[model samples]
Target chain A: MSGNSNATASGAIERLWKPLVARSRSKRALLLMAPLVIFELLIFVAPFLILLRISVSEAGERGTAYAEGTWSADAYANVLTSEVPREVIVHSFTIGLIATAIAVAVGLLYAYAIWRADGFTKSLLLFSVVLPLLTTLVVKTYAFRPLLSPTGTLNSLLESVGLLSTPLEIVPGLAGAIVGQVYIVLPYAVLAIYSVLATMDWQLVEAARDLGASRPRSVLEVVVPQAMPGIIVATVISFAWSVGSYAAPFLLGDDVTFAMRVEGQILRDFQWPTATALSVVMIAAMLVVISALVAVLSRFGGEVEYA
Target chain B: MRRESLETALFRAGYLVVFAFMLLPLAVVVVTSFGASGQIAFPPAEFSLTWYESFFDQTDWLRAFDNSLLVGLGTAVVATILGVTAAFGQEIDDGLVGRLLAPLVLLPMLIPPVIFGVTLLVYFTEFDLQGSYVSLILAHTLWATPLVYFVMRSVFRRFDWQQLDAAHDLGAGPVRSFVHVVLPNVKHGIFVGALLAFIVSLQEFVMALFLSNHTTETIPVVAWNQLRNSLSPMVSVVSTFLILISLGAILLAAAATNLNWLSKQLS
Candidate 1:
């Protein structure tokens, strides 16, 4: 059966390209992809190159943003040595780890629930997730101010329920920042896991159960291994977005994140080189982290077992 | 069996809590939008449209809303075109160009928008195009096109190319086949892609914050400024309105395609 499946897959691949291989070499294929490639080069690639250049350029004179056509490693050196940038980077990574962990864990459970559900319940569960994906990020992040502030709804509810003697300031604090960050990334995380879960065969878990595997044991062995791809995607997304988060930290918390520092450099201090350098360094770090994550996760994703 | 039932009940109760966490903020904003008092109070003391009236009365807010609409529509059209063509080209050819273009297009979505915004700010400043609608639309298009591409790639993957083969076996030419046959089947996917792009541009704030000026400021940017400066109910009204637009777009896209298709693209 496995050999037959492999033959079918190979045949399908051959069929997919038999007609297109000839046309791919024609000018039409180049024409088809040219506009988008050129647009990306001009808009996306060129700007990053410029950002790289600015990162190495010397700080500008009193009136300027950056000194054009001058080379200096001062900005990079400053970023490495300066207390503020170092603190901001650490803070950003901390938030990223925390938010990514929570988002992935909760997202897994939520996706499992949705997958286990049927009919109207399943659709409703899925729709609720996508609804937040479409809503404005800033608006939703800002709403946390009213919902979690010291005198906000959560505190009031807790107090009324006799859970608290006084309202504590959750907003403009670390807790608010994490909650808001998790909220921003949760929908994507759920969707990612659910997408994988939707395609999974439930009988694998049932078979595990029949083999005397406990419920949690069955899920850990059968479900999580299969869902590894989605988990990786969700982790990278939540981590990267949280690390470079702007709206949540800016609106709900007083913590100075890497993004907020970049904003200050550009808008307030006019330190273009520093801001660009900081961004360049963080982007490099993010690439390293994400690559490592994908590498490690794919190892777990290897060799899916058939029931 | 009793143990299984109890476990299922506990799992459901936990799931409902997660669902509430997701919807809490948006529900708060909607509820507060109708608060009659000057302060933002939850479970409003009284219901009224005073803030909604204020939002409409303010010319600056209205102008920002118009700017957001303009940018969103522009992004939708440009992103859909680029995304469809690129996905089509990549799908047909499994070559070096397709491999290269696949990751290159998706790079924008993965990178931090703050970095992208600052880079565009510097890039546009060099060209004296900073704070212009063209700059805002271009920045948004770069961000949004990747989403459309992601969606359409999956759409094209599941596409029945046998139909294209049938058209080719007939007397129809390549272009004619693509126009008459290839496009019709994928039109729903195209519509959903465009709608997704529109929503992305409408909600995007980081890039617009850097690229837009007072005259060209988008609704999210304006809302950010207002949120920073004041806790006005008018912001709530604007948010409520934006939420409605996003919800409506999602419903429309859902109607055009289906939830299953959307979920597949998401992963």
Candidate 2:
């Protein structure tokens, strides 16, 4: 087979080959990438540009709106002055920060467990970390509805355990939002931090232990410091995701984030201007967070390459 | 050493509780789905498959499920193609071109899906393409592509490039060599990429919320609507099915790449 093919190869200067050889090899990558690049620019970038334009445009009593004379900042002004939109922005940030804290705390344990355990335990730990992602966020949060609702699983369990005399109102508020966001962001935290630790040299930690430091001390001094950059990255990932998230707060009945606000403005009020403005604000906030992400990636590319 | 061991034991116990918290919601949901009792109670007095049956009985749930499956499959195929192409492009040109393209390709993942949802909602309304499956699938493809590209890129990076050279030297054309030589080696990446793409599409909610309407609603969208209206046992039944599919996907991913090897793929 090789001999026949080799003969064909050696004598392959055919009528169909001249231009192909001249132009094909060098332009192969460019051709391969053309479709994806075009799709992104059209479907992703163009829409965002449109969103920006739409924010300045008006939304009338009838339907979608366009600018009348020049671009207007009325939508922005309304959002700033309005009670709901302004509070949504601040509340989302607060939830994001809280969610980031919870994610880091739980995620650190999961990462540590994965890093320490060897065989089956490691996979189990890994499984727990990733299992939340397996189901939709809505489904998980929906399940939480029962547990956080009156006479639900959590209340029943707590009551049966003699811990509570009255049912706790854990759902449909900021606390529920935090719990839901934590559930969503925890995996990301584990993944981000674990990705860094996976590439890290373990010899240093062992050396610290050998030099008479306790395990906790050694970890605090050696492991935590080395993994700090990753922790920061993980924190930012969780925070950004939470801030930009719609599902968690929406499901928890705390649908007051800028993301959810955009949806609400569109669906409820049919007000494209206010929604677009809120979207722009959300994108701006995300951009700020993303810049932080970019900064970390640039400074610590080697640490998070696999992530 | 004794004190440190005690600390380690305490941590183990703490993590046990944390993991329990992790599993609690899912367990409660699953358990309740099989219960005979009404009103979303815990530790049921009896067990039944009433909810699962009711889920099948409803046409709305079935239609939404069908739409979800259709869109998920479409997104998976589209994302995998784009991902494979981008991965190939990166492999072929690992210079400034690759570096420049990386962030742009990764833009969908970096930015929030809600942002894309909002942008597309407005854009679609403008272009008169609103509420179409094509529009929704395209939006989801944007979300799923980056993951596939990353997975495939890693798989390609770890392969031996010499095998391809050998195939070429043996007189195979580029396409033939890639099919006969490279494809076999990278099948795992393809498998993982496809499954990851599928899962992303299956579980996607935000984009579908903005893009889909009555006819084209995905499962997550339907579930969200149902949850907003009332807590039905059918939601659990549907969620349970999704969880089962996710399990299948994970097992498939594990089979595609060696579990231990893939576990440390992040490293």
Candidate 3:
């Protein structure tokens, strides 16, 4: 294994150093790729490089940053030591984990339902999932207000119906953030899980049932295992999505998430070091998530080929 | 006639409940937009088009709406060119270019928009491009092209390249063959991608908040500002308008293209 890796490493270096191979690239292909590549380099790659530099940068006044100084790890140190950053990071994870769990639960059922249904029923079900996304997230999240607010329509209705004695403060807190994030992320989870479930062999579940497995047992043993890849993908997607959430928490409450803190530090306090530090942390989290996603997807890709 | 078992019946009913849960908020917004009571409330005492009228009367809202339209149009055009080019480019050399470029081009999708927004704001400020339509469109284009790429990749995957080969063999040049043969076949993908890109830019506000100036303020940013200040019924009016127009855009594109490409690509 070591010898094979050594050969590949040296081969990679040779490929990197070779200009003759680069010259062999088709002119037409290069021309076609020119616009997108240049656009991405300018707009995507450059900005991200700037972001990395800014993260390591010494905290400057609001407008001018990294104007004169060498790179510094002071920002990372500040982020690690800050109470707000620590609490907010933990808070974001807890919210993301809880929301992803809820989304997975509902999304699995919805995806399974879509898989089982035929014809227009399937379309309607899928459309319903996608419909929420069609509207602006603010619209959907704001709509939660009338339902969850103290003395809002829901509480009024509940009071009249004798179901409750007082209003609930659910819409402007952690609960509200979870609801909004789950609402936003649920459709993705459904689609992710559905992609796998749609191709599953239902006959296996039927066989299990025929061989004395109960319905729940058959699903638990057969269906879940078959859909495990998708479930895992959906969970990771939703978790990443929830962790990166800013808008939902922005509408629900203030300074409620790590994302909000990043925004706040930049726009509110003009604390570049702390904001960039927090962003670096978030970016690290994103990289970890992306690597996990890529690793699982590659493994899943291998499974398909082997099958 | 055969009937579904209790389990199947319950499952279908469960889907209905979930649908209700998902769509009920939108229903409330639509209904509340026409609230005649002048206060935002569900199941209002009466209904009116007053808020809709107010939405039209306000210059700030109209300018924001127009900015969204103008920026959406710019973003759609720029993103389509780049996206279609990249998508078609990926087909060349049997995927060499795409394999090398995928990580860079697709990174924007994975980056948190807030982080991206901050990054753009910081960069644009240094470059003196802050609060300009060029910057806004570029930021939007960065966010939107990947969607177009995905839609067109699936379209290209299902496409047959022999038609283009035939066109090339007939003495038509590369551009001509693309415009004549490949273009006709992939127009549905182009249409779907452009419309989705337009919608994505129109709905995106995070970057807009960072990148847009007073003159270039998009509708979502305007709406976010409005919502942050207070939960006004006028917000509902604007949202209801957006919802209607989006639905109209989808249906128009679907009908005009004579293909359900939008729904198909989305599914």
Candidate 4:
């Protein structure tokens, strides 16, 4: 195994070195790539470096963002010990968990429906999924307010059906947040699962069903395994976006999520160190959780043939 | 046979419910935009275009719309150029460097926008570029380029590189060959990528909110400020306008490339 790894390593090195020495083609390629590399480094990488710096910097006075060049762990400590931030973290994770679960479950079903659909039905189904994706994130998310508010259409519909005498407040609540979050992520999840399902052979499920397995049993056995990669992708996308979401929670719900808290710290409070520190902590937590999620989901899927 | 029919019926019903869930908010917004009432009411007391007129009448809303358009167009142009070239770069250099570059471009897509927002807010402040059009466009380009890069990557894969080689052999320069040979073939991809980038820039809220001042606030940023204060039918009207623009762009993209091509790109 060591010898095999050595060969692979040497091969990788050869591939890397030979391109630089042997051909002018790589030179041309470098020229083409230069603009993007510099742009990303300047705008993407440099800013993150600034964020990291600011996170450790001492708190600035009123009207100042942060005390630059003076490093301290006070901001991290405060966030770790704080009550409001703790609740915000928990709230963010709760929304992420609930939204991911619902989005993935519904996405799976929606994908299956699209797969089974024929001709115009199939196109229409696909179009519906894509439509929301193309629509502005804030606009679609903001729509939930008018739809789910106390005097919104949903409550009116519920009342007319005699489901409730008066509207149960959903908007400006957790339920609204989850619903809005799910709506935002659901399209990508559907597409993720559908892309995998599109490549799957329906005959396998049919064969399983013909051999005495029930419909659900056949699907669970055949379709679920095949769709596992997509499900995992869907889950990760939903979870990450949900946890970091600003629009859904901000618009439809009044909850204090991590993103909202971070916003408050920077914009409203002008506590740059606290905001950056909180963001750094949240980002670290997200990376760890998402990595763990991928690891667990990969095992559950048996083996993911990543395309 | 009876069981199979029952299963199909159940599946159809289940699908309808899910579809309703997916489309309801958007449908409500569209319906609500036409409401003539001063207050946001459902099943509008009457249908009128007063809100749409109100949106058009307001200078603040109009300025926000203009800023959104300017930023969206600028981001689309910059991102498309970077993404297309990067796609070319990756395709040409399929070595370790290519592998490294591929993930680097896509990294922005994975990182949360809030982090990007806050970080850039600080970075731009230090540089004294805060509230400038340049900062807003550059901030948007960071997000949009990755999307354009992904789309163009897929586009490049289906493309034939032999034409480029032929153009080179015939003494056509890289620029000339790219412009004459490579571009015409992948025009559809370029159009689609640019549109997607435009849409991304147009809809993006968090980054704009963090970076923009009152003068530079995009439609979503303006809408967000308004949303916090009150529920105006004018906001709904603005949203409807955004929806229409996005829909038109999507349709244009679909026309440029088939629906299947679009769906495959989504994955």
TM-score of each model's B chain?
Answer: 0.95, 0.94, 0.92, 0.96
Tens-digit lDDT track of model 3 for B1-267: 123377777777877888888888888889989898756788777988888887778999999998999999999999999988887877764445567666667667767788888989988987999999989999999978987877888888878988888888889998898888888888978988898889888888888988999999999899889888888789888988888877776666656553223443443
Give the lowest summed-lDDT range of ten residues in model 3 chain B.
Answer: B258-267
Candidates in order, TM-scores: namely: 0.94, 0.90, 0.89, 0.93
Model 1 alpha-carbon drift over 4 Å, by segment: A1-24, A304-307
Q: Give the chain A TM-score for each candidate.
A: 0.89, 0.81, 0.82, 0.88
Stretches off by above 4 angstroms in model 2 are A1-25, A65-70, A253-255, A289-307, B260-267
Relative to the unseen true structure, what is the C-alpha lDDT of residue A275 in candidate 1, on a scale of 0 to 100? Answer: 97
Q: For candidate 4, lDDT tens digit of each residue in A1-307? A: 9999999999996896566646544777877777998898899889899899999999997788888799999999999998998999999999999999999999999999999888888878888888888777777887877678998888989999999997988998999999899998999999999988988889988887787888877777778778999999898888888999988898888778999889888889999899998898988998899889888877757542322
Q: What's the CA error at residue A144 for candidate 2, in Å? A: 1.6
Cα lDDT for residue A21, candidate 4: 45
The candidate maximizing DockQ is: 4
**What is the Cα-based TM-score of model 2?**
0.90
What is the per-residue lDDT of model 1 for residues A168-257, given as tens digits with 9 covering 90 to 100?
A: 888988889999999999999998888888889999899989989879788877899899988998999998899999999988888899
- Please state the error at residue B146 of candidate 3 in Å: 1.1
Off by over 4 Å in 4: A1-25, A302-307
RMSD of 4: 6.1
Model 4 DockQ (Cα-based): 0.59
Q: In candidate 1, list every pair of residues with a backbone clash.
A: none
Better of 1 and 3 by DockQ: 1
Q: What is the clash tally of candidate 2?
A: 0
Worst 10 residues of 3 chain A by lDDT: A298-307
